[model samples]
Target: MWYLGSWMFPVISAAMWLGMLLGMFIYWEAIGHPIYPSMDRGQTIAYISDVGAYKLKPLFIAGACVTTVFLDLGFLAERWLRHAGRLAPNTSRAQKVLSVIAILFAIAGSAGLILLSNFDTYHYPRLHDAFLLLFIGGYWFSAIFLCAEYQRLGIHYRSHHILRLSFWVKLTFIIVEFVLAVVFASTSYTGKPNVAAVFEWVVALVFTFYVLSFLLDLLPSVRTSHHQPQGWALKAEMEKAHHGGQQPGAPLTNDSAGPNQNRHVAPGDDLEAGAYRGTSMTNGPGYPAEHNDLGRQKRRGIGRLWS
Candidate 1:
C-alpha cells in the first residue's frame, strides 16, 4: 500500500505536467495558424475573439481546462484528507471553517473551467464571462482563504523549512497574480490591454508556475501521509495482512530497523476501515525521526493550499 502511494504521487504529477504542456502547445499552435492572418485585429483577438477559426484552439483549451479540474480537486482532497481522521477537537474552528471553504471554492473553480470551455464566448458571452469569473475568482478566494488558515496555524508542521517556504511562495503568487488580474481587468474600460496577447500569456504563465510549485511539494506530502492509513488506503492495508495469512494484529517491522522497531497492530483497530484512533508507530535511531514522524501531530499541523 505504501508502494501505491509512492507511485501515485509521481503519476498524478506527471499527468498534471502533461496537461499543462499539452494546453500550452495547442494554444500556441492555434495562435500561429489564424485563418484570417491579415485581418487588422487587436491583440485582444486572442483573449476575446478568434475561436473555431483556429481549428485546434478549442480542443486544446477544453482539454487543458478539464485536466486542471482533476489536478485541483485531486490535490486539494489529498491534502485535506491526509489528517481528516486525526483533527483534534481543539483545533481552531475558524481555521477548520476556512479549510472547508477553500475546498468548496476549489471545486467551484473546477466546475467553472468546465463551463467556460463548454460555452464559447462567441455565442454565450455572458455565460462564458460568468464561468471565467468563477474560474479565476473562485481560485483566488480559495487560495487566500487556505493560506490565511495556514498562516494562523502552520508553525507546527514537521517539514518546518519546506512548509514555511511553500506558504510564502503561494502568498507571493496570490499577491502578484491578484495585482496582474486587477490590471488586466482595469484595461477593460479601454476595451483592450496595452498588449492583450502579452498580458494574457503573462497571466497564464504566472498561474502555471504557481501550480508547478505545488507539484514539487505534493509527492513528499503524499508519502508523509502514507505512514498513517486513511480511507480506502486503510482497507487495502488490512486486506494485505489478511491475504498474507496474518491477522490484522500481527506484528510487522522493517527487518533492517532491528527487532526494537517491531510494530504490533493495536487490538480492536481496523474493525472497519478508516476508524479514527491514535496509532502507535515504531521509530529507530537508524531512521531519521522526521521520516517516521507521520503522526497526526504533524500531518494535521497545517493545511497546504496548493503549495
Candidate 2:
C-alpha cells in the first residue's frame, strides 16, 4: 500500500539514528575516551568527529545521517503528493502553492543538513552554524505547511483519527523544539554551555522519536484502498501460474476462484487485494495519487510535470 511506502524513509531513518548512536558508543569504547551523550561538553555531537582517535566513526555516522535526511525529504514529498494529487485541483490555488513550497523547504533542509554535517564545527564554524539554522528554519516552515495540508485532508476523512493526531503532534513538537532552542541560546549567554548542549541533544532525540512514530501506520490492519492493484490483474497473474490459458478477467464468481477456497462463494468484488499491493505497485515512489478530485485521472506523471 502507498501508506507503507510513505513510511519507508521514516522507519529507515529512525533505525539509522539508533545505529549511529550505538556506533558512537562503540567508537568511544575503542578509543578509551567516552563521549557522553547527555553531558554538556561545550560541543555538539558532530564535533566528536574532529577528535584524533575515533574520527572515522562519528564522521561516517554524520555522513550516513545526512544521506538519511535526504532520503527522508523524498518521503515527505511523497506524502505531500497524496494530498496534492487528491485535493489540490479541487481546492484553492493557495493550498497548492503552499504544498509545493513545503516540498521545496524540505529539500532545502536536507541540503542544509548535508552541509552542516560535512563542514564540521571545528573546520567551518560559521558555515556550520548557518546550515544548522537553515536546517531548523526550513523544516519548521515545511512542517507548518504540511500540517495545513493535513488539515485539508482531515476535513474529508474525519474518521481518520491518525491524521488529526499527527497534525497536533507535529505542532506540539515544533513548539517544544523552538522553546528548547531559546533555552539553548539563553544557556550560552549565561555561561552554561553544558546545559545548552544538553538542550541540543534533547531536541535531536525528540526528533528521532518523532520520526519513529511514522511506523504506526504499518501497525494497523486497516484495509488500505490507497494503492491496491485491481481485482482483474491479480487473477490474471494467478491464472498464468496455473496455466489455465484464461485471459485475465474478473473472478469467476465462485468459491473456487475466490480468495478463500474453503469458504462459500463471495462475490468477486469481495476478494481481498492487500497482499498483492506491495510497495512495488505504487504510482512511482514519490507520486501518491493517480486520480484527482474531479474524477479525472492520470497515470502518475504522464501529465505535465508541474501539474
Candidate 3:
C-alpha cells in the first residue's frame, strides 16, 4: 500500500501537467486563427454591434461536466476512506461545507451551460454571455474551496515552497479573470477576450508550476526525507520517561505496597517516603526516644549537683 500510494502522487501530477499544457496550446491556436481578423478598438466595437456578440457556451459546458464528475468521485473516495477509519477526525467543517457548495455549483453551472448551448432563438441574445458568467463564477468558487481544503489538510510539500505560495497567487489571478469576464459581459467590445485569454495562459502557467511542485515533492528522494525517522527526538522522550520513574536518594523497589504506604511514615521512622523526605514527631509524646538527647543531658547535670 505504501509503495502504491507513493507512486500515485507523481502519476497524477504528471497527468495534470500534460492536460494544462495541451489546454494552453489549443488556447493559443484559437487566438491566432486567421478567420477572426485582428482589428482596431473602434472596428472591434462596430463588428460586435453588427453581429451581436456570442458567448463561448460549449467551453463552459465541457468544464462544468468535468468538474461535476470529479467532485462525485472525490466524495466517493472520501466516504470510502472514512468507512475504513483512515481519515483524520479533526477535518475542518468549513472545508467539508465548501466542497459540497462547489459540487452543487458545478452541477448547476453544467445544466445552465447545456441549456444555453441547445436553446435557439429568432431574436435571442447570445447565450454565451450567461454561460460565461456561470462558468467563471462556478470555477472561481471551486478554486477557493480547493485551496481551503489544502489549508485544512496542513499540506506542506517538502520540495516546493512555491506550491504553498502560488496557491494565493493563483487565487488572485482567478479573481482577476472573473472580473475581466464580467467586464466583457457588460461591454459590447473592450478587447476583454484578448485580455482574458492572456490571463488564462497565466493561469495555465501557474497550474503547471503547481503540478510540478507536487511532482518534485513526490520524488523518492524527497519523499524519504519527508518521512525520515526522528531518532533523536524519540530517544530523548524515552530517557525522560525513564528518569521520571526513578527518584533521587530512594531505593527502587517493585513490591506490592498500599497507595498510602508512600504518603504516611511511622513516627521517628528514618526510611524516606516515596516523594516526601521530611521527619515528623510521634503523637502523644514530647519527643521520641531517639530525639530526647537534651533531656538525658539535663538529668545527668542534676545528679552531679546533688552529689
Candidate 4:
C-alpha cells in the first residue's frame, strides 16, 4: 500500500495551503481592502462594501458552482480509476492537461474579478455566468488535482523530469502573473474602480507568498541534488588521465590536440584533428597534443552541460 502518511509531504502541503489562504484573506479583507463599495461615493470613500450587493457576486457565484460540479465529476472519475488499480499513482498526461485547464479557469476568475471591479453595470446573461461559474469551480478542482499530482510525482519520482518541469512551470507562471497584476494595477484606466485595484494588489501579494512557499518545499530537493553522492572514483580517474601525459617542466599542452591520440596529424599539426569526436589537435610550441585533446574534450563536455 502506498501510504501517503508515511511522508511529511502532506503535512507540509496542508501548512502551505493554510498559510496562503490565511494570508490572502488577511490581505484582501484587512490589509489591502480589495473589495470595493457597491457604488462610487466619491474620491474619499473607501471601497469596502458588502459582498451580497456586489454586482459581481452573481457572476462569481455562478462560475464557482458550475466549475465545482465539473471538477467533482473529474475527481470521482479519477478516484474510481485509482481504486480499481487502473491508473498509476503518478502524474500522467491527463493530470497535466487537467492542471492546465484548472490554471486557465483560475486566470479567468481573476479576469472576471478585474472586469467586475472596472465596470459598474457589467451584466451578462445567466448562460455566460454559468460558463464563468464552471471555470471558477474548476479552479478548486484543479487545485486538488495539482495536490494529488504533486504527491504522486514529488514523492514517488523525486527527480523525475515531469515533476521538475511542472514545478518550474507553475512557479514561472505565478511569478509572471504577479508581475502582470502589478502592471495592470498601475496602468489601468482612470475610471477603474478602487476595489479592483486593491484586489489585484492582494492577489499579487498572495502569489508572491505562494512562490516563496514553493521554493521552501523545493529546497530539500535542491539540497539533495547538490549534496548527492557522486562517483569520486570515476572523476579521479578522469583527472588522472588528463594529467598523466604531462611532462615535468614542459610547457602546458596547446589548447588544441586530440585527447585520445586517435587523429592523424597534418603539417604544422594545424589539420583539425578529432573533428567529429569532440577532440582537436593543433601544433604549436608549448602545446602538448594531449592537452589539446583534453581541451577539446573539455569544450565538448561544457557543451553537453548547456544541453
Q: How many backbone clashes does candidate 3 have?
A: 1
Give TM per candidate: 0.58, 0.58, 0.44, 0.27
TM-score ranking, high to low: 1, 2, 3, 4
Q: How many backbone clashes does every candidate have?
A: 0, 0, 1, 20
Evaluation by TM-score, superior candidate among 2 and 3: 2
Per-residue lDDT for 186-257 in model 2, tens only? 885587865665576576667676566554422222235553322233334546867556555745444554
Quantify how close model 2 is to the true structure by its C-alpha RMSD in Å. Answer: 19.1
The candidate with the higher TM-score, 1 or 4, is: 1
Show pairs that collide, candidate 3: 55-128
- Once model 2 is optimally superposed onto the true structure by TM-score, how far is the C-alpha of residue 113 displaced, in angstroms? 1.1
Model 4: weakest 10-residue lDDT segment is: 222-231
lDDT of 3: 0.43
lDDT of 2: 0.56
**Candidate lDDT (C-alpha), each:** 0.56, 0.56, 0.43, 0.42
**Candidate 3 ranges with C-alpha deviation above 4 Å:** 1-68, 71-92, 112-125, 155-307
Error of 3 at 191 (Å): 6.7
